[model samples]
Target: MNKQDYDIIVMGGGLAGCSSAIQLRSQGQRVLLLEQQRYPVHKLCGEFLSVEVISSFARLGILEAVRKAGAHPITRTYLTTSNGASLESELPGVGLGLSRYQLDLLLFQRAQELGADCLDGTKVNSVSGGLQQGFMVNTSQGNFSSRLVLGCHGKRSTLDLSRPFTGQYNPFVAFKGHYTGIALPGVIELHAFPGGYCGLSQIETGEINLCWIAHEKILNCKNSTLPDPLWQNPVLAARLHSMQCVRKSQHRLSQISFALKGKFDADVCMIGDSAGMITPFCGDGMAMALQSAEMAIPLVTGFLQGNLSERDLKRQYTSIWNREFRTRLQIGRLLHASFINAGIANLGVSLCDTFPALARGFIQATRGRDHGANLATSDI
Candidate 1:
């Protein structure tokens, strides 16, 4: 019997990769995590983590670390449309406000503490293989072999080589920045404007996370930056009157497709943004990334343990992945599609308020059992 370099190789050490590393190491598996960026780097995200991470990472100690880091506790929501039609609702569960800069670093360190081999500043050029040939991963440093490879490479990566495996239609572009001198009412907020929606929440550092998503038309092609439409909507503008954007924290990503992504792409098991993006306006995409990690590691464990064949492992994982996320992704697309029309958006909220079941269904379907417990709008 020969030994592979690692039992598993996880590409891209964001939420999915790092969380997968932490869990697999916890289960006594040999895991290798390859990440391109150094720790503490900012990534474009709403930065509002679902409280669901509490029960999921309960044994991992990541939750406690988040709380200790001063992650704001949120139990309510405030939403405003492009027309400034505002409404408030109580959250069924608690949420945490912490930037990816903090969250990713914490998870990366936790994986290291648990003895998982993590390679930072290493970029994976490509991944190829199967049960018969085993898995071969080529990185900037060198090539390595593993029994299984999990692609957590985010929304776009070199692995989407050749033409592109994921959807590449008219996609949304997202922008994020940290701002000082702005305060919130300890609730999660989403403000809508033409072509985009912004999420506002306070993080551990006492700064507001001004993250928004807009149509690709808003991207500045020459500089790869998003124009300052942060104040285009009067409601959004009012919020920023006293706040100053943190130049260092500005981050943006273009071509954010809402098209349904596959469970597996290019022979690599895709998770997180690599798998598919959730609704920028309606759901907790961050938590969905963390949840993807939980879903894959267990099945991968079975394959490495020889309890399941490679074929069975992939089949079961796909089945489970579809079961857990399909409905949520579908709901997100519907929400995104409807949000395009302000009239429908306003009416949808009204219907949700008038018919509590619609709101509850939308929340449960998109947020899962973990959140949307008391949501008051959007399904209709």
Candidate 2:
């Protein structure tokens, strides 16, 4: 067998890509990580970090860096409707509210320190070949080849590969901005509106991350600017009154899809949003990204070392990945319906406020936990 230019090529420099690069490089594999954009930039994310990944970050030696970087401790959940009807519940455990600008940069630098060749401002035009015959990757910067590839290129990418879920029209358009002066300490607020819902939580710099997603048709203009209709949501209006935008501009992304994507796409191993996307309301997308990379490192290692064949590697990884995430994605899809309807959200929050125990059910339902598992709860 001829040696490829690199052992593994990780597509995109997001959480999953950088994470797998770090682990695979630590195991002596030659690694290359490509990102279309430069770092130290904000991404369209809720910036909510679940407690489940804390142990993994500690194991990866980045927990102290995260803490020192001023990651905020998130311990409470506040669910609200457009009318100001709301419910408060305790989170299953403590999570961190860290901005992607800080988190992704930290992971990118760590991967570089571990000897992974990290390249930014490189766009992937196409990906071909597979585990059996090695991979050929063409980027705006140059052409490269590797023994394997990890497609952490996010929910949508420049790659034109058609897959099972590609034909669906993705109706979601998302907006994110940073604001200050909102007293959201130790709390994450999920305020439901007509077209979509908004999330507010404090990040490392004590700034609130305001992210919301809605149907593209709801926007009065195509410029992706804030629509006044969004402010009509009473809960958001209250929060807005107490806060001011930290920046003049906001981040926007379109064509967002929550459809379940396979762990293997275009014959390349997939991770993070590439593999599957949980609706943002679940607050588990970031955790799933880190968890998928952790799950893939060993299989990626085995395949590269010739200990596992292509067929066995694909079967094992696909099976395990499906087992872990499929149910969560399905539940997220189901919950999406109830959340978007104004009447349902109004009634749900009002009922939940009256019965805190029932509100815990709503929390547990969206969270990626198995049925019959107990969730920690409290009343406020």
Q: Clashes per prediction?
A: 0, 0
| lDDT for 285 (candidate 2) | 89
Model 2 stretches astray by more than 4 angstroms: 221-224, 368-380
Question: Across residues 1-380, which tens digit of lDDT does each residue of candidate 2 receive?
Answer: 57789999999999899999989988999999999998887888999887676766876778879878988888889888877687888777778889999999999999999999999888888888877788999999889999899999988876635876777899988999999877688999888888788889999888999988887777875445456656778878877878878784378899888988877876799999999899998888888888889988898899888899888889999998888888878888766667777789888778878888886776676555422123132210
Q: What is the lDDT of residue 367 in candidate 1?
A: 76
Residue range with the least summed lDDT across 10 consecutive positions in model 1: 371-380
Candidate 1 structure quality by residue, lDDT tens digits, 144-234: 9987788898877767655254444756777789999878856998876666678889888989998887776655445344345545556
Candidate 2 local lDDT, residue 271: 93
Name the best candidate (by lDDT).
2
- The list of candidate 1 runs beyond 4 A from truth reads 162-167, 218-232, 354-357, 371-380
**lDDT, model 2, position 284:** 84
